[model samples]
Structure formats: C-alpha cells, structure tokens
Target chain A: MKQPHIQLKLFAALTPLSPENSDRVPIEPGISIKELLDHLDIPIVKAHLIFINGVKRSLETRLNGGERVGIFPPVAGG
Target chain B: MKNTLSHRLNTLALKASLTDGTPCRTISAAEVIHLADDTGITGRMVEIAALREQILPDRYLRNMKTLSEADQIRLLESAVCIVGLGGLGGLVTETLARMGIGRFYLVDGDMFEAHNLNRQLLSSIDRIGMPKVEAAVMRVKTINPGLEVNATGAFLTSENADTLVGSCNIVVDCLDNIQSRFILEAAAKRAGIPMVSAAVAGISGHVTTIFPEDKGLENIYGPEDQLNMAKGAETRLGCLAPGVNLVASLECMEVVNLLLNPQKALRNRLLVIDLEDHTFETLQLA
Candidate 1:
C-alpha cells in the first residue's frame, strides 16, 4: 500500500529546499505545521506565512495526510 | 449658465484622431485651460462639462473604448493617497496622474538618496537631498496641472494616518516595513476606505487589496511578533527594479479597479509573483 501524502508548495528562497524541489511530498498522518517545517528542514523564522489548503492557518495547526500547503518567507520592501 | 459652458465647450471641440486614425470630437488640454480661465470655473469642471457633452479631452482620447467618457470624468474627480514615495509609490503616483486622478495626498518623510536611483521613479542625481513628497508634487503638476495635491513630508503613523487618508477614495500602501504597513492598514480601516498594498524583496513580490471590513496585513505578514522582525527579507535579499515595478503595477491596477470597476477589485486575496521562476499565484486570504 502507498503511504498517504500532502502536496507542498514552497516559494522564493524556500523553493530550493522543497524535497527534491518537487511539489508532491509523502507525509505521516497528523503532523503539525511546525513539525512538518522541522521535518523539511525549514527554520521557524523563515516560515512567515503559512496557508493550508487555501486558508490562512497558524504554525500550530496540524495537517492530516492529503492537504495542500504553501509557505512564504516575509518579502517586505517598497 | 451650464448651457453657456456647454456651448463654449462645443465651440472648443474639434475633430481629432482617436489614436487609431478614427476621428473624434475632442477638446485639447490647452483649450480646456483657456476655457476654465475664461469662464471662471476650475479646469476640472471644464473637463467634466466637456465629457458630459461626449467631447473627449484629447489627453484622454486614447482611453476611449476601454473606459467610457463618464469613467474618465469619474477618474477626474477621484482622490488617492500614496503613503510612500519610493519605488512603488513613485510609479503608482506617476501612472495614476497620467490616468487623470483628480486629487492626491502624497506622504513621505524621506529624501532621495543615491541608492534610490536604481528603482525610484521620481529620484534623480541633482535632486538627491530634496524631500520625496516635493519631487513627487513637481512631477505630478507637470503631468497634470489641474490636479489638487496635499503633500506632507511627515512619515505615516497613527497620528498622521487619519489626516492622510481622510476624504480619499482609496489608499495605496507602498511602505517598506511590516510595522508601517500595519499602521497604514489600520488608518485605512478607520477611514472606511480600501487599501491596495504591495511589497518587494529580491526578485519576488506580493500584492493584495484590503477592504475596510476585511482582515488586513496581519494574516499575510503574521501577527504582532513579525513586526518585531525589524527589517524583513528585503534587508538581506534586497529589492531590484523588475520586482518593484511589477508589484507596483499590480497595486496600481487594483487602484483603478477599486475606483471604477470595484466589483472586480482584488479583494480577500493575495497575488504572489516570483520573477525568477516566472510564477504567479493568487491565494485566498482571511
């Protein structure tokens, strides 16, 4: 049987760190967003904006298998 | 009498090219000025009177089919406040002025420095020490002398936000830091106006429009803690021209939409653009 997974999208500086730079990522069930970031080697500081399945969510929000996630670094300038 | 003004406008109207070789009945900018002086009405009223008669101001003839004459007149009566006169605010002010926005409240405390020349639209070598708002007024007046401008060199803070945003149809947030963005969003909310915001760092940028009733920058930049981040990615990654102009253009487009076709404004969402990867995405926001 295949392991359950979530689609992951990383942006800007975070893009290079996506697993194999691929959008598809297999995940263990019931992982918190912060835990997932840790699993992916993203520091908590760089993960400024987090959206889970099109909704703004907190780093503490847990993700079950089969969610789509996006992470953006704080890109602030004029 | 309004009829007399209309009659005078009719006398001023002449057959002019509608920019594609099509003949159009239009009043030249010069003619509008002369008529405003002759009739003792503001140039804005003269333009409105001309538009009501289906006579195009030659300066706006090119906007014909895309925007109706009434739309042009609406543009002529609008007020916009641009909070930062750096890369994004400079382009937005210049572009909107050319588009015929009638009034402006330009606020920026900084002066042009050598570093601004790379991307700031209003900065030049000779004007290095001039206040950004002063330079902005000079450029705006030269573009459309009919415009009314209230320029301030004080920075945007809660004390000044209400004054800057009052009576304005909408606000554009070209501010560079997270702290100021929060302050601007709050002021726009209190004034019950919409704000179109954009920011750039490295080759990437983000654009979003916030309606007064909706949640603002906190969702995108995170809660109060992120504000303490001091400088953001821009400090380390730096901003370049392509990222600045592209994001600023998106903000300006949102400005136009909110003013005229407001139903189509980019509300409740964020547009992320990565020039290096050439990818653009719109994600729903709270």
Candidate 2:
C-alpha cells in the first residue's frame, strides 16, 4: 500500500491554519491550489491573492513539498 | 503661574547666559526659582530636569552652559516633517514630542481604521473614525503641550512633497506604499535633507538612514522594479504592536543621533529585526 502524500500546507497572517499554525488544513501532493481549496472548503473569493515560497503564484500552479503557501484578503486600510 | 515661572526663568537665566559666558548647560534650581514668574512653571521645570538627567549622563550635562536657556528653548523649537503617521511614524512623533521637538509637519491622509488599531499607537476606539494625522496630533499634544503640530492630510505626491520636505530638518519615511516612498525619497534628495526610512511586514522590519547622494536603499531594495513588486505582492500579514514599536524606536534613535552627531550616523545600512526568531542584524548597502 502507498502512503498518502502530504505536500501542501496553507498559512497566512490572519487566516485559518497557516503554515506557522498547527491547526492548518493540509492537502495531499500533486494537487492544484484550486483543487485543494475546493477540498478544504476555503473560499477562493475571500482570499484574493496567493503566494508560494514568498513569491506570487497562480491558482493553477501545482504544489511542491516543503513549500510555504500564504493566502491573504485584499487590504483596505492605510 | 506656571507660564509666569517659565517665562521668568527664560528671561533671567537665558538673558544672563546669553549676555555673559555661563556654561550654557542645564539650568540650576536658583535660576529656576529666580526666573520663576507669576506663571509658575514650578512642576514642569522639575519634571524636565529629571527627564534630562535620566537620559543624559552627568559628564555630558556638565558642559551645557554654552547655550543660553533661550537657545535651549530654541532647540525645542526646531521642526521635523514626518510622512506616513503609521507604525513607525506614530511612535517617532511620540518620541520626538517627549524630547521637546516643539513643532511637527505631519502628513498622512489615511483614516484610523480597525486594522491599524493593533500596531499604530494613535489608533483607538474613540479615534477610529478620525484621520491618522489628526489622531496623531492629539496624541502628541497630550504627551507635550508645547509641541506645535500641523497636519497635511494628503498623500505625499510630487506636487507638494518638495515644499513639505524643504521646510524640515529631515524627512522620516514610514510609508507603506512604493510610489509614495520613492517620491518622498526623491523629494528628500532633491531638497538635500536626510531621510530615515523604516518598513515593517509581519515579524520582519528594516531601518535605514539615507542621505541625498547615497545609493544605499536602492541597492538592497533594488531600483523601482523590485520595490513595486514588494509593494504589490505584500500580503497584509499585519505586523504586531511590538514589531512596529521596536522598528519605530530604532528609527527615532537613528534620527536623534543623526541630529546631534552627524559624523556617526548609520548611513547606507539596513538594520533588520526578526522578532519571531529573535534575531537582530544589520546589512550594509554601500
């Protein structure tokens, strides 16, 4: 039997279960960000931007091991 | 009575020291009492003396007689122009006000919203709807009544930046946006004033003192391209209060040291602080 791939970890400053957070909702490997968000019940519309390893990445990008993914809402204040 | 005493002290001690060759240092109790007018600055002078003594050692205090009480008064009258009244600028204004910088040209158009309540010192429940500049002015006045604060509630565009930057001893860039920061830098350079800039993102922040002819900040942050990227990609990770306070305190120290001793200023270097990992480091850009 093959082991389950646990490659994606989501984190953010004011988000649910961020990388620096332990309550994170992890996802299996070989999944796109859109798929993972769908599986985790996270609203992509609420999270306006995404980044991997501190560089902005597209939603269609696939996850890699040990990558730090961050999600954030649009900033309205100064 | 307080103002009377302060005025009397100002007249006697300042007149004697200005006319004669007194040490021009800290005023003595006799001078304070003799100068005491009906206004009665009885408590304020004592408080100022205590603050000065605490911050300045006896050795440095012994040689102060050179400047008259009037001149000491003038030092307090110096003006500073600060941009961005946010994390760094808020605390910088507070520190300078406590130090008796009598005047400030505060420029910022943002309102005090819920998000800023965490790190910005002036953000309060009562002040949530007020403009940042207005809130900061109130806080500074509460700290020191003598400070003359003027607000420019406008974004620092190239239109009025030169006029604003030209009027102060130095410019402090605590701005978050890139284009505005670059415009402020350009204005400072064009006006030939030193700019002490600081940036805080999440648990990381950096402070750098930039002189007009120096290429220090452009080196680490890169030219306009990287700065724009950093601005655009910047997630509102939201800095904690402690992080902003630490970086703001450092910026204030840099400004004060530069004002007093220009020869030993921290020029062309970025002092980075990472509170999450407990790391304090410096990167030289020259």
Candidate 3:
C-alpha cells in the first residue's frame, strides 16, 4: 500500500517554510487545509489565499492525498 | 468639446488609402497639432474631431482593428487616476499614456530614489530627488502632447484622497502598502468608479479589479485589525522589476478592458502570477 501524500507549494513569505523546498510533501488522509498548515507550523493568518490543484480552496477544505496544494501570502507592493 | 470646433476639424479630415488597399478617413498627428495651433483648441479636441468622422489619427494607426475606431475615441474620452509612482505606478502610467488615455490624475509624494532605478520605468540617476509624479507627467507629455494630466506631488491621505481621485472614468491602485491601498479603494468607492489594483512581492504579483460596490482590498488583505496597517509580504521577500512591470501591464489591460467593454472587466477575480514557476492563474474572489 502507498503512503498518503499531497504536493505542497508555498509562495511569497511562506516560501522559506516549505518542507525540503520541494512540492512533494507527505500528508495524512482527510486532512483539512487548516490542519495541514498547522502540521507544517504555518500560521493560518499567513495563508491569505489557499489553492488546491489550481483552484481556490477554503481553509476548511479536506485533502485525501495526491492533491497539489499551493498557498500564497498577502503581497502588496508597487 | 465644442461642436463648432469639431465641425471645422471634420472638414480637415481627408480620405486615404491604406497599404492593405482599404480606403478610410485619416488625420496626421502634424495636421492635428496645426489645427490646434490655428484654432487655439486642444490637440485632444482636434483628435476627437478627426475620430468623429472615422478619421483615424496616424499616431493611433497601430491600435486599429484590435481596438475599433470607436474604442480609440472612447479611450481619448477617458481619464484615470494612478496612485503611487514607484515600481508599479511608473510602468502603469507609461503603458496607459502610450495607449491614448486622454486625462490623468497622478498622485505621489515620494521622489525617485536609487533603488527605484531597478524597476521604476521613469526613474533615472539624474532624477534621484525629483518627485515621481513630476517625472511621470513629463513622460506622458512627451508621449502624447495632447494628453491632459494633473500631477500632485503629495501622498494620498485620508484628508486628500477624495480630491486626488476626483471625477475620473477609472482609478488604478498601484500603491505599495496595504494601508494606502485601502484608503484609495475607499475613495474610489465614494466616487462610484472602478479601480484596477495590482501589487508585487519578490517573484510573485497579483492583479484585481474592484468596482465601487465590490468588497475591495479588505478581501485580499483581510480585516482591519488583522492586516490593515501592516506592510505586505513585499517587505519581507522584497520587490523586483519583472513582477512589478508584469503586474502594471495587467492593471493597464484591466483599465482598458473596463473602458472598452465593462462586461469583460476583472470584477471579483484575482489573477496571480508566479515568476518562479512561470504560471498565471485566475482565482475566484467573489
């Protein structure tokens, strides 16, 4: 049996916090976006916009593995 | 805007054959300037008169087909207020001016600094201490002497936001900070105009359009206590030229789209670009 996993991508200020600096991050099945952030020690406030496989996702959305998650921070500069 | 002047300009309009063998009425930029000098009218008026007769200006020849002659006239009749004159604001003004935006209200109290040379299109070593707004206004004039612009070398504050964005067809929020952005958005809301907003941070940038009735910057940056007065991710990650210029170009496109076709405007949508991955994605903001 294969281990449950999800690809994680981080952007902006959160880029430094990405695990191994790679998108192939393992995750627990049925994990909510909020929980994934918590597991990675990424504060919820810093995750301004959360996306799952190119589509916008709510913090409460659940991931069942094999999903690509991208999180972005608030970017405001000229 | 006077009909008598327009009528006189209409008579100056002459039919010409294009390289494609299509015959159409056209007016040269020189002819428009000459008419302005002779009649003591604005070159904008003369250009408008030429467009009224379907006489396209030689200067706007490149915008043909992509923008119908009617759209060119619409652009000439439009005005936009661009707040801030740093990386994003500088390039946004440059693009819009070239696109034939007739009037502009430029606001920025900041002057060009050494760091601006990397991304600010109008910045130069010689203009290190010159106000960004002044530099932008001069550049716009050189691009199209007929364009009218009101440059304010003052930062947009609560007391002056209303006046800074007064009576414009649209507003472009190229501001650098979260607080100023919210202030500009509120002013645009009170004035009942749409605003094209964009920001940059390191290798990433995002563009969004906020109309008077939209939720505005608060949605992107979150609640007042949570993020209002805070600096954005840019301070931590830093800003660069590529993201800045790309975002400004996107904002210009939004401005033009709003002007030519309101239905196609980027209302309730956030388009994000990641330079590292070279990906552009539109996320729902509604």
Candidate 4:
C-alpha cells in the first residue's frame, strides 16, 4: 500500500526549520506528533503548541493521513 | 441627592467646554482634575466625566454606541493589572486607558533601553534610563488623567504577584518569560480573576483568555518543568512591533469583551495569527 500523507503547518520561528520558510509540508502517515517533530528536525522543546485538525494534541498523539497539523513555537515575549 | 450629583455635573460640564468653539465640545484634563479635587469625590467626578463628553474628552465616544451607558459606567469602575510594561503591556495599557478603564496597576522591573524604541510604545530615546512603570504611569496620565494608576517598579514573583493582582478584576499576561507567566497565572487563579494573555514573535502571535476554572497557561506551555526546559521564540527570532501591537490589540479587545459581555469573550480556545500569510486560526484546546 502507498504511504499515507498529512499536511503540516509551521508558525513563527519554526518556519526557519523548513526550506524558504515554507508554511506547509507533506508528511508520512502513522507518525506520532513527536516523531513528526523529530523528522522535521524541530526540537520537541521548541514545539510549544501542536494541533491536529484544529484540536490541540499532545506530542504522543498519533496522526492519521490527510490530517492537518499546526505547530507553534513558544512566543513568550511581551 | 440625585439632584446634587446632576448639579455638580452641570457645573463641571460648563467649566470644561472647549474655547475653540468648533462645536466639538470637550473638557481639558486639567479641568477634570480641578473638579475632582473640589468635589472630593473622584468617583463622582469620573462618572460625570464619562457621561458628559464635554467634561472629560473621550476618544471612545463611538464605543458608547456598542457599549451601553451602564457598560461605560462599568468600564469606568473596572480595574485591570498589566504585568509588564514592554511592547505588549505598553500598548494594552494605552488601549484600556483610551477605552476609559478606571484604574490600572502597571508592573515592571525593567527600564527603557535604546533598543526598546523599536516596539515599546512608552519607550523613547529621551527616557531610556527611566523605569518602564514610571513611563507607563506618565503615558496613562497624559492619555487619561482620570485613570487611577499604581505603578510598581519591581519584578513580579510568586511572593508579590498576588498582592499586585489581587484587587484587579482581570489580569493581562504581558511578561516575556514562561516562568513569570506561570507566576502570573497562578496569582490570577488564586485571586479568581480571569487573565487575557498574548505573545508575539516575528510576524505571528497568539491570544487566549483563561478563566479561573480553565486549565490556564499550563495547558499551552505544558508543565512548569517542561516550560523551564524549553526556550521562547522571542529569544530566538526576536519580536516585531506590528506583531506585538496586533496581538496586544486583540488582547485588549478580549479584555473589554470579558468585562462587558463575558459570553462573547475569547475562552477555551487559542486564536493565532500569521501576518506573513495573513492566516488566522482558532484552535480548540484539549
């Protein structure tokens, strides 16, 4: 079977992790949010908020194919 | 007794009329102070000032259309604590003061630096050495003299957070560090006050409202230990003025909505904005 794919969105400082600061990327399926972060080389400590299909999820949460994922860095500045 | 209040209001109203005679009648800040001093009842003076446009010049004259007279009175009676006086806190305090919020507790331990001129509304080259809280106080006085402000030039710790925010109806999280934000959230929770929090980095930022019953900042930033281990984007990407102002404006709007119409305030969700692509997303918190 062909590998399933998911859409990923990186925000703010996390964009630099990707080429040309592309906001979206396609990822393989059956990956936990933590694994995806690692695959993208985004440190787990740098990923402050993670959401799948508009619902916040923990790092251990598994993502199915075709789901939309959004990741934000901790932006604590006043 | 009602007649006495009306009579005093009318007297002050007459004293406040603009001499320019362009028909945009407005009172000077000096007149309001004089009236409040003479009446020995600042609350009554504030009420009269809010009611009569000519008595205490308000930029929010149109806001009264959406906010009923009673709501305006409520704003005049409300007090909010701003825990920082940097980019976000400076703008938030200015907006609230213009919206006629009656009292403010401005807290910050930092002083204005030359670099702060990039985004801090209250910071300037002339005031580089001045304490941020003092600058905020001066700015609020210039914006609306009727506002009662308590400026604290000390950093907020667990020990002093409660005392600084205990009397406020709401707390705005403007601190730049996760540890300090946790301190503020705990303090607000202990005081049973709702907190409107926001943060900015690059061209993006996020805002959320946390009531006492909610999970609070911990849900977004994770456990205290985890937060201590992590780094904030501001430390890496730095901050942009437009992003800070945008997020702070949204935070102020949430605060006003919370105070006047709690049902409409942003709660239980985080609203994130990316000016780079102009995409705004509201994500539900687990």
- TM-scores of all candidate predictions against the true structure: 0.92, 0.63, 0.92, 0.88
Instruction: Estimate candidate 1's alpha-carbon lDDT, on a 0 to 1 scale.
Output: 0.86
Name the 10 consecutive residues with the lowest summed lDDT in model 3 chain B. B223-232
Error of 4 at B262 (Å): 1.2
Index of the highest-lDDT prediction:
1
Error of 3 at B240 (Å): 1.4
| C-alpha lDDT (0 to 100) for residue A77 of candidate 3 | 81
Q: Which lDDT tens digits does candidate 4 get at residues B1-286?
A: 6446455555545332223332333344566566677767674345555465433343444564576556777787889999999999999999998888988999999999988899999998899999999999999888777678988999999899999999899999988887888889989999999999988887798999999989978778887865564347777777889999999999999989999889887788999998987979999985
lDDT for each residue of candidate 1 in B32-99, tens digit (9 for 90 to 100):
88888888876777888899998988888778878888888898889999999999999999999888
Q: Model 1, range A1-78, lDDT digits (tens) per residue?
A: 677788887776677778873556777788898998898888888898788877778889987777888888887799
- Candidate 4 ranges with C-alpha deviation above 4 Å: A1-4, A19-27, B1-3, B11-31, B48-59
Which lDDT value does model 2 have at B207?
Answer: 77
- Can you give the lDDT of residue B281 in candidate 4? 92
Q: Model 3 over residues B1-286: C-alpha lDDT tens digits? A: 5547667667777777655677877778888888888888777777877887778888887777788878988998999999998898888899998888888899999998898898899999999999999999999988888888999999999999998887798999988888888888988999999999998899798898999988877667876566644577899878988888898999999999999988888788888898987968887776
Residue B105 miss distance in model 3 (angstroms): 0.6
Instruction: Give the winner by DockQ: 2 or 3.
Output: 3
Clashing pairs in 4: none
Q: Order of candidates by TM-score, top first? A: 3, 1, 4, 2
lDDT of 2: 0.63
